[model samples]
Target: MLQLHPEQIAQRLDQLTELSVELGRGAAAGMLHGGDITPLLERIVLVAKDMTGADGGTLYRPSADGRSLEFHISINDSLGLRQGASAGVAIGVPGVALWQDDGAPNLGSVAAYAAHRRVSVNIDDVYQSGDFNFSGMRAFDGHYGYRSTSFLTVPMSDHEGELIGVLQLINAQDRETGLVKAFSATDQRFIEALAAQAAVALTNQLLLRQLEQLLESLVNLINIGIDEKSPYTGRHCQFVPELTMMLADAVHATTHGPMADFQLSENERKQLWLAGLLHDCGKITTPVHVVDKATKLETIYDRIHLVDTRFEVLLRDAEIAALKAQLASPAQADEITLALREQQALLREERDFLRHANIGGEGMSPADQERVRHIAQRRWTGPDGAERDFLDANELENLTIRFGTLTDAERKIINNHISVSIRMLEALPWPKHLQKVPEYAGGHHERMDGKGYPRGLTREQMSVPARLMAIADIFEALTACDRPYKKGKSLSESLRILGHFSLNGHIDPDLFDVFIRSKVYLAFAHKHMQPDQVDAVDEAAIPGYVP
Candidate 1:
């Protein structure tokens, strides 16, 4: 037996102590930031071979059904072999079967034996030992003119005492002569400690991955719930993500522009994409009645019908006046009928005019709005058994709205969605990758000059993603045909408005320029915009464009 003197043994022990410390630190780091199991698995085999002075090694993880031990990693300094996910190479070697076709544990192979028995298998020389099968190894040696010698196989068990995998090292070499030697007790013990750390690290990593997947699924479910509550909003949620990606992809693809230095890793892209999907998630708290408001006169229904009722009262009063004139002077009955007919015709025209006005439009002229006030000045009887003005105070305010359908109060309610959305997202404790989600989602409504809502972050304070979403939000709303209040603007009109916003410092100037140059507008037009809404956009006419 080869033995060391006391002084030599002390030196070896000290080296082993330092090696252990380094290996422990490496294992801990791999556990936390390995990125994938392949790296961690490759790490285990490489480190084990270094400590034991082994010429080659392999790591085997049990197949999903536990029917075979799949070779996850195979590395060898002597054979110049590297195979597995980490190397981006296909594992050419056939996997070792853990169980026979006859449903018996295949304990003939050394790695399988360690896995089946849950113990370590150490051999002085595989060529001499009559323990487990080495026929495959012998064949490998014959083909390569290499020696099949020492073997040490150790089973890796996790904290739950479940077998995670097996680690096998072969052909331990002499420290001085470079000759093959048997693996010693010290070498086997060191490998066993590494196997233990590997097993636990693998388990924790798998658990972390599973947890992240769960959280991602929950985010999707929340979006689905929002869609179910308001389909109009749901379409907006789905479309914004797609459009955001298109714009982001454009910036990424550009090589010689303002955004050339800007790019996103797969994870960063994922983070931005998710933020887009959840930009309006706070709309879940908004009242459905307010969100679906279709017209200036809409509540539970349009109040135009109430005005129709008042018109009927006036017509009834006119018919009564005609009958009274006929009774007072039968000879003048024909004159009274002609006069009443003219008055009745005027009332019908006025009623039709008011009905047309009630259906909200782009712009109400000052003269048209004044005409509505004139109509309101006429008298009618209320349902409360009292005489009142034809149009009530609320009706006057609604009819005379200078722009879109929403009154100031209703607009405030609609705007509160951003505040609510920020609240919902900020409440969650996000993982590192998703930490910017709330910021990105919340900043969609903010402006370049800090004239936005909830927080009103300035351009310098906002991320490119937030500014990009602001443009997306406005364009989507402008071109959306499914909204209750207004006609979808044609592509030209939408671009004109977007240009105005960009010039006014409502959105990022550079991103808007990139958007124009990249034809992101064209791509979105082809995908989502209706053909009618998609019209030719004049480049020169577009506001703020130097081209």
Candidate 2:
């Protein structure tokens, strides 16, 4: 046996204390940079193992039961051991420590003490423990080929003084004799300090994880609300983000004159994607009835239906006149009844023609135009004998070729949602990375030409990323299968229209062509469009549009 002066022993203990303190400080600094538990645990184990000069060590955290501690981190001489090979705080050699409660036990007497105390115990010499009486002790030594005779154990507790777990060290080397020896009193003290630091680090990490989970759950709830509001727009709020990311990736791949300077880093790209996802979050404020309007006669004052009902009343009046004339028994009465019936039928026919004409979106033909004027000019009388006008000049003009169900004011209100979106996003104190969300999300409806609402920003004013989103929004709406008002256009038809927009300077022509040529739209269609609802565009229909 080697002997050392008391002063030398004291100096070694101080050095061990300093090392433990340094490790704790390092872990504390790391925790401030967004604490992640796994990495923190790994670092704690490596540093502790190196300082103690142990063959190996494992850190155990208390299970929910608090009676048993599960391994949280394990470091061997070189690498980690398989997790389940040694588990259960009371079923292995490691179990002795958790079963003994009193003052620390040496290797020679730990087994007997562990059985007696039912709390943590450490063993320094397995061969000399003749009085120790643990049934699993011999089996544990045999299984791991035990040759060393040293151990250290410490309890882990939170700031509240609640026991969190235990730290165990095995087979520490004797500095002078170069032989395995039982863990010194200093080793035990050092471990106790390290365990305290670990408890604080772990607590912080758990709290952060809980907060992240809460944020994810909230975002999902918002998405569910969006899905529930409109039957025809299922998952639009979710799909927009995915499409935006794909387009952003494409832009990164092919750099052009202006696009070359506007490259987004990986983090910036992620922010753009989040912006797209939350772009329509303001749509929650819009009325679902307006979004799903199927006919021009949609408002509370649906004038077209009023016109049809007036025509029905005219028909009934004609019938009454005919019966009266028949009862007169005069030859002049028969001519008057026939003329009234013919006039009533003509008015009914004219009303029907106008109703169908308002729904026509295929660009009104010459005959359709003339029928509109004739219907507007016709008049009928009410039940009170008050003269009723079916259509005023202004109403007639608007009803002639209905482009959409909403009135101009209603359309403006809906378009104004982009500004609403911007305001809502800006109100939130978003991370700096996501600060551009308001701009990118609010500009999805803007056109390259100075014709879009809210701001009417032209090509130079809008970001390339914003332009990509605009294209995506229009393309998705045109090909959407679930909208109530119109059947989804075929892909070829949609592409032809997109091409027209490109020529008219509403969209970027080069980007549109590139998207088609790369078949990027095909990928997006496959992912978002219904299986039977998607098809390839015919290049011929897209005149001069080469992709």
Candidate 3:
């Protein structure tokens, strides 16, 4: 036994009080910094060892199936051993089986027995004890030429009174002689209290992780709804977040540029990721027919089918006229035959032209649009026994759009999605780090010159994340094959277009420069673009980009 003088006992009381304060403060802090669960668990175990002046300690958590106690944290002061993800120094250490194959508690192991019994076990000397097995401890001591004794094992029961894990402290030392001694009654009591605090910290961390995972799953569900709504945009929801992270990582790593100081914390990275995943969530409300428009004459059905029917009507009328002329003047049959041939040829040519024009193209010339108008003016009979113009007003408007597919009305319907998206995002009560998610996701469509929709925020008003997403949106749009608008553009062409946007203030100039200079464009292209679309880019040819 180690006897303590009155002065030494007072000193020990002060140290124990300090340790209690430290444990309480740590538990309170753990709730906020639950993100550091692994590290926090390790710290708690080490702190327990410090409180008892133990030379070695370990902390274990229940395995996934609740069959065993897996080592989460391990430290040996005498052996200078540290292991776990938290400490970044891993060693091969087997887990403890809390229950035997026959469903019996593992009483042969101190840590396992403590966890199985949900109680604290204190032994003044393992070599002198017969109540429990300490054979493994003897083996460890034998190999190291050490006398392992003075064991303290406590079950870390959670608030719900379920044992989550166990903490084991070994080899309490004498204060004056630096020799191993019995763990005191005070040490056992203080350690049990520390174990309680550790349990709270661990529980808080686990709950926080579970909550974060649940949130991510919910975000993914939103994106899944959007993806199901528009097949063309499923890839958009997936790829944009990936590209956003890539560019953000580049920004984080850059130490010698205008964006060198622009770094994202882990929390900021997560926020941006969530924003990217939910960027087009409001598209769920968009009409699928308009979203998946594949042709100029497309609606519920392609109106070109109606147009084809009218051309057939004209062909029938011309054939009837030709037959009448042939029968009326058999002597000049050859002359009538030549005129009929010309009319048939002209009708066939016109019908074929309309069929070709129905497919959406990047641009429609004024002359071509005028030709469509003339075609619309030709007369045809309807099913109602009324003779109407060849094309309806809607049909003509869609055909003469001067660009891909959509008419003025349809374009407005498509453009209003941004407003709805902003409304949908702003409705949520967000936390501080995530308050900007709506802003970041909402600003991808915005222009740098204050010409953007919903809110005409200029370059200075947007965040770096917003600016990064803009480039991602444009580049992905230009290279995505899933869209109904046009074929995916080549990498060089896309970069050239992106460069033009930068010079014209359509996108953030600095971000575009970084996108080019850091080779982020190439990185994205290599991963997302089609093999043929991944063409070599000419850096000098790209306007607004310097060497």
Best by lDDT: 1
Candidate 1 local distance difference test against the native? 0.83
- List of clashing residue pairs for candidate 3: none
Q: Write the per-residue lDDT of candidate 2 for residues 1-547, one digit (tens) a residue.
A: 2344577657656755665565566455444344444555666666566656777776676566444456666555623353422332232324324333554443433422332343455567756655555345456556666554565666666666666556767777665665677766665655666666676766655654565456457666666676788756546676777777777777677655434555767656755776777777777777876666665555444467777777787687778877787778677776887788688778777877777765636456767667677666666686788775656665565565446556676677777767877888788776564577677887888788889867898988987778888877788778777776677777777778888998898887766765676567788888777766676667656843763
Candidate 1 runs further than 4 Å off: 1-37, 64-67, 93-118, 125-148, 161-164, 249-270, 299-355, 377-392, 431-433
Which segments of model 2 are wrong by more than 4 Å? 1-40, 60-72, 78-140, 147-168, 174-178, 181-205, 252-266, 300-306, 332-341, 358-378, 381-385, 391-401, 449-451, 457-464, 508-514, 538-546
Model 3, global lDDT: 0.81
Sorting all predicted structures by lDDT, with the top scorer first, yields 1, 3, 2
lDDT of residue 220 for candidate 3 = 85
TM-score for each predicted model, relative to the true structure: 0.82, 0.74, 0.90
List lDDT for all candidates, in order: 0.83, 0.65, 0.81
What is the Å distance of residue 278 in model 3 from its true position?
Answer: 1.5
Model 1 clash pairs are: none
